[model samples]
Target: MRMAQTPAAADGSSGDGALGRVPPQSIEAEACVLGSMILDAMAIDQVVQILHDDYFYRPAHQIIFRCLVQMRHESKAIDLVTIKEDLVRRDLLEKIGGQDYLVALAEGVPTSANAEYYAQIVRDKALLRQLISVGTQIVRDAYETQDEAPIVVDHAEQSIFEIAEQHIGDSVITLQDLLRHTFEMLEQHEGQLITGLASGYTQLDELTSGFQKGEMIVLAARPSMGKTSLLLNIAENMAVIDQAPVAIFSLEMSRNQLAERFLASHARFNLRQMRRGVITPETWTALQTAAGTLETAPIFIDDSASLTVIQLMARARRLKSLHDIQCVLVDYMQLMLYSGRATSRQEQITEISRGIKALAHDLEIPVIVAAQLNRGPADRPTHTPRMSDLRESGSIEQDADVVMLLHNEDYYHLGEEGYQPRGVTDLIVAKQRNGPTGSVPLVFLKDYTKFESATFGVEQPLGEPMADAPF
Candidate 1:
């Protein structure tokens, strides 16, 4: 009768035999584990780490196990007399069959040395029961939920992922353990130029030891400030040069447009001419060679124009598991959709920012997110972008590990008297949680839509543009 009510028995396809059989459990293993803990107080520590109260199948065993754990927490001895007294004080003595039951458990086990082994069996059985419950829930949700198919699938995947992560357990450690781990990491990074993935920019790499894992990096700028160009350059450097897998979620541009920019930037071809189908022979050959190299680079681009934060996280999780992607890029945050019940745009932005930060921490990878600034920079006397200028909400700045604001003075003085288009852009490191903040100058090659480290006082030549130049 008990077996018929078990979660595993709910599946009619499992046949009558499975429904009639008992749920996966071992009462003897539970008895042995409790007996071992009672016989030797020192053995309780090992058993507690593996088995919890719910791990015991029988109600009496569960109550006894929980009581023993409570006694251990109170620094009380685990002998029979103390166990009975504590149980009596809590009105649970008769409920768990009194002192005779405790004596029987202690006498049932041969030795306390096998406590861990007994605990493992109990844990395994508990895990099987959990799997049965999760599977039953998944089936129920599939048949009854009103959500779309993709949302349902995402929920199921997340549920299974949670179960898979159970083996990882808690990360708490003693100071001695922490010191040993730190020293090991230091030794592994000894004589290394950078401790994280290199961004391929000389000074930027120096300012940040390259983008560290599990960090949310925000790049903010006004419209047409070359934020997207700089993001692509960094992605190209990591994916093409370093052979690292990168996932790019572009809500603003199509994949074809992105590919064209990558080709022009990498091959040094004129983007305007390429768009006009007027590529010269030399440029054609260079583009072909660049395409051959880029064809093999592990860069995955998703040009979904309308992406919710939940969908983005689900796709990122898939890419990280399938391809071991080292980094992720979202081109501009204001365009992302939030399906949750947000009262205002600011609340929506806050949730989106937190979601991106959570993704970085969960995947243990650096996530570079492009953001748009407000009119604060343009209205100011200095025309400089600040962390406070981040649009929609303050949560973006709060959540980011690094905040880079792009400013090109040339944009403000395009046709002024004696004004020159020096192609110089200032990447202001306004907020860095772990390092000093400063501005790094870069040269933005408008012709190829590329950016590189700039030499001070050096001006890049700007040739005349084509009649139909997109810019």
Candidate 2:
């Protein structure tokens, strides 16, 4: 039998500290494997074919490869500093370098991050083996016990209508007729039981029924695009005017800051004035009215920074059971955490996207998430954004049923342009797996950090925008 090789405890190679006593030979072997993998991992298809590892994690190799993987997308220098940081974190590498060493290390051929992908395959294989073993044992036990006829599970998959009329078979009503009848019934009971939430933005609602139930939406944009404002606007309309339960998970902003923004928007008080306790008597009356409105509204918020996706899900589920969360909006996707995952930012984001999607499906509500756009968008002469502009476009675009990018020309132009488009916000529907892709206009109330219907904030003077907050 071949003996397993384990790394010996470190003997202070670079003086980070004592290692875990991994054998020196094992460490050498790992370095060799990593070197070969680094070279072989050139073409993704070749690497996939050669590795044959359904899933795998090369903690030893990833120490070097993660940097290279990031470089494939852009020309980023992976110097000794970054390597030292990784090694320091793991106590695997020591910083014994100057610029010359950094330059030498940085010159190594770049590779891809196929490691995590392969690791997933290995995991699946391991799970398959376990499942087969368990399943085989179950079958053997069932046979020995001489169980009755196999438990009847639904060998037949059927739609709601099919199941409803199974016994009546051939003489069933056509699906179209049934659908028409159902629509008629729904129309008869309009505004009762089932209400397709409208975004309050006319064009947006025309395109999407205000982000339907159990939906996880990634509402991404570059800095200063007002993703928070849009959500606050929607939440305001929902909680105060429409009177629906809403929750806000704010990672960067404080709870008080958010409430202040709400007050600023709802009462048309200057955002700075309210934030710094500078409200005058007249504005205080508006603030009091806004306070009363907040007291009676169904808005919940959690502004804890660095919250993971799992934590968010658990909290969201609890909130749903308690307050009936009909819709969920994540301020931005990139801010979320993957918790126990040991993968690249892209993979972590993919996991988060899947989690949010699951949360929507399981909870039977719509979720909207804001995301950061890549720097590429800023370089374009045109103000329009696209799918490629998404920060980590890989699984985010793939998993999202609808992807909306928010932009304000006014924010971009800085008022230098001859014609300033006031209260103009762009809803660039870069991708819609279930619908069309295009642009829609929205209203931006910059100070209030809120977005309203295009005409909703039109009457407000520039300095006093959001004076007639819907709530």
**Model 1 CA deviation exceeding 4 Å by range:** 1-28, 80-111, 138-159, 167-177, 191-193, 276-285, 457-471
- Model 2, 297-402: lDDT tens per residue? 8999988788877777777777887898777777767887666444788878888888888877767787877888898668888765666677864777777777
Q: Model 1: which ten-residue window has the lowest total lDDT?
A: 1-10
Cα RMSD for predicted model 2: 23.7
TM-score, cand. 2 vs. native: 0.57
Rate residue 425 of model 2 by lDDT. 80
Best by TM-score: 1
Where is the poorest 10-residue window by lDDT in model 2?
Answer: 152-161
Candidate 1 local Cα displacement, residue 89, angstroms: 5.5
lDDT of 2 at 289: 92
Q: Per-residue lDDT tens digits of candidate 1, residues 1-471?
A: 011121232222234323476668887788889899888888888888777787777777887788888888899988989888888899977766667777888888878999989889998888877777778788999999998766777788778766755762243689999899878877876754466777888677777778999999999999999999999999999998889999999999999999999999998888999999997788788999999989988999999999988898899998998999999999989999877778899999999999999999988899999999999988987888878889999999889988888999888887789876767798877777776666788998989999989877432221332122112
TM-score of each: 0.81, 0.57
